[model samples]
Target: MRLLLFMLGRSIKPAVLITVFVSVVSCVMLTFCEKGGYVFDKEYDSVFTSLEADTAYDKVSEMADNTRAQNDDLAKRAGDYIAAHTKPGSTPPVLPDGLAGQAVRAAQKGGDSSSAGQSELYEFMGSSLKDGKESEQLIGDKLSGYKRNARRGVTDEYSLALSAVLTRDYEQVLDNQQLADKLYDTRAANTYLEYIENDMLFFVLIFLICFSSFSSERQSRRLSAFAITKAGAGRFIFCRIISAGLVCGVCAVIYCLLQFCVMCLSGGAGCLDMPLQYLKGYALSSYAMSFGGLCIAAVVLRVLLAEVLCAAMLLLSFLSKRNITAGLICLAPTAVMIGLSKSDNSTAQFVTCKFSFLFGGEGYVRVFSTPYPVVWLYVLICAFAAGALFITLIAQGQRREY
Candidate 1:
């Protein structure tokens, strides 16, 4: 226990203070989430806002109706041909790659003209809703729902633009839950983004952890003289990496718990009911970002370089509008296991909350898969373990110059 405190003490109090400050800030900002709805802000509201409008709805509906009428006219002609060509007991053409062949393949795949027809019907219904009856009712219902949940007013211009998504035409699906599900999906994505963009303190905590860990160690010569003793370079290095990683893990846990408490107080049970899967997702994300910092310290012999690189990597993960922190964490072990993979910016949309992996947030909707967390976390921990071995190897190889 004392040893653990000693290791944590090696990190300056400013780092601890930074973590606390971030936690407080995370709580304050996330409070606005209750009334804010899912939209990021005025600037990017278009990303999620539906694009249907009264004028455009009418036009689309009219166009769909006209197109369906044309298709109906054509279908009648085809029906006439079918009736005239068949004999009492004769089969039709078996030519491959023809319309009939295409029909047959589509049938095997459980899809065909029926599927196309249904899609066309949906499009037609949507268009008719814009141009036809109940247009005003449809617009009102959508706007009311958005306004009730949203923190701010959506502009009239954007609201009019997004009318299409809300105006559905299908008679069959008009009663179905498809629209509800779609709205939920959009909200889920927006909720995730909202948490990511607002968690500035999470980023600050990460930078502080990395910078302080290395700088403090350098000033104290804490890792010194492990060289002259029987403490193998491998064991000594592993200890330092583990020590640093554990500190990061503690800070991350505190950050999350504090945020969770704040979320509960401000938003009530609705906020706290964030599913278990997302909780696990948050844990994995914290480990990935934290471990990445630990590994950086090992490679760059100078603590300052290590600290700067850690800060830089955290920033880089956000550049592509997709999180790649897990992937970067995975590379930690690669440096020694098979040589570091050429670092490149490849964006991925993970099933679990990618933000949870990148920062400590409790606002995830659904858990997609656990394999990503398990696989990457193991790989990252291994990287830190390998970094420990490398340090040990350095200690053993270069004897004292006495």
Candidate 2:
């Protein structure tokens, strides 16, 4: 038991220090970052109109009024586009330049059209037209249904926030054509998630960090020495997994705490009562989620995913002798996971399988209304990860030589 404890402690020392450094760096970035605003000055504009000009104020007001009118026109066009293309089995809508050209242009401010098959503008509009309206209507209907069934003031908190947001003229928001299009698209609670989505990059970094962790000793040929210790091969393998799991789990917790601290410091921390949201260009309307639901789901998901990745990397380390091969195998899900994150067509959250890491982020992002199912999914995935670790332990135990 002492030997096992010593090995575990030795393995996690470096990881703990690394976590502290990473958390400090992340908190520093948050301390300097603007709430829901860009950290870089890439969009800085130097040219300015002189306010001394006689007609400057008039010109600006006129421009604002004209822009407002134009947006109202665009909103009509968008509505027409949605009505026309959303038929059963019909192709998704693509608004003509004459229709939503302005909205598309606004959403794609940072996107380049010439470089890709489909520009970010196209993707944003398509997602907005497809999911934005559906989300809005879903919340509205749910709120109305609950209102009819429940006594006064006994309504769900999400329903109240959702109804309040929906009470605002959604058409007006779409018409104004904000750069992010967040005006009409997201639930109030989703604002917090949207602000922190960039934080997911850190999660990827964590995965990469853990990927090399198990392979390190094996590459150094020191793993064999430890396997023949007084604890025997089985204990050695299990202890190694325990060490990795502890490291990964602790890292996940630290990352989450640091992230939330960043959110709080950036003035976006108080979104618990807000509803969950879907991304169009930004947060969607109506599809409110309970903030509590989203928080629990996201935290649990991160921990489960970190542990699973650590275990998988351990198995891959033994299955393939080449570090590059094992690392690639461990990273096989990155692209697919990203794609699933952006897509709403993923299979049910409860259907986690071998590609559980390829599972959608929405399962947590939208967990306000889907708490139980997604929590169960996380539990199931963790179980599978444990099973995989046990199998790895047994397989490694059978081998007498490195």
**Which candidate leads the pack in lDDT?**
2
At residue 387, what lDDT does model 1 achieve?
A: 58
**Best-performing candidate as measured by TM-score:** 2
Q: What are the TM-scores, per candidate, against the unseen true structure?
A: 0.35, 0.53
Model 1 alpha-carbon drift over 4 Å, by segment: 1-5, 9-14, 33-35, 38-193, 197-200, 219-237, 271-402
Q: Could you give candidate 1's per-residue lDDT for residues 1-402 as a string of tens digits?
A: 454456557653655677788877776676666335422233223321343433444544565566556556555655665676767889953433454444444334223444334335446335223212342244345446655544365555434333222232122223331222221112222232346333445544655564333233334454355545665434444454555555555666667656555434432333222211122223212121221232232122122222223433322321222223433442342232122112221122221113332233211222242112333443454456445544443353344212
lDDT by residue for model 2 (1-402), tens? 675578667766777677777777766665555433421123211101222222333433454455456556667778887897787887877777755556766455454322121232233223423443344455446456555644466566655544444444343333322222322222222334543443444546455656665466677766677777766666676666677777778777877777765655444444443333333332333222434445556666667766766676667666665677767876765544544455445453232221222222222323464322344655786779767775765577557434
Per-candidate RMSD, Å: 20.0, 13.6
- Candidates' lDDT values, in order? 0.39, 0.51
Q: Stretches of candidate 2 above 4 Å error? A: 20-140, 143-192, 195-200, 273-293, 322-325, 334-344, 348-374
Judged by whole-model lDDT over C-alpha atoms, candidate 1 comes out at 0.39
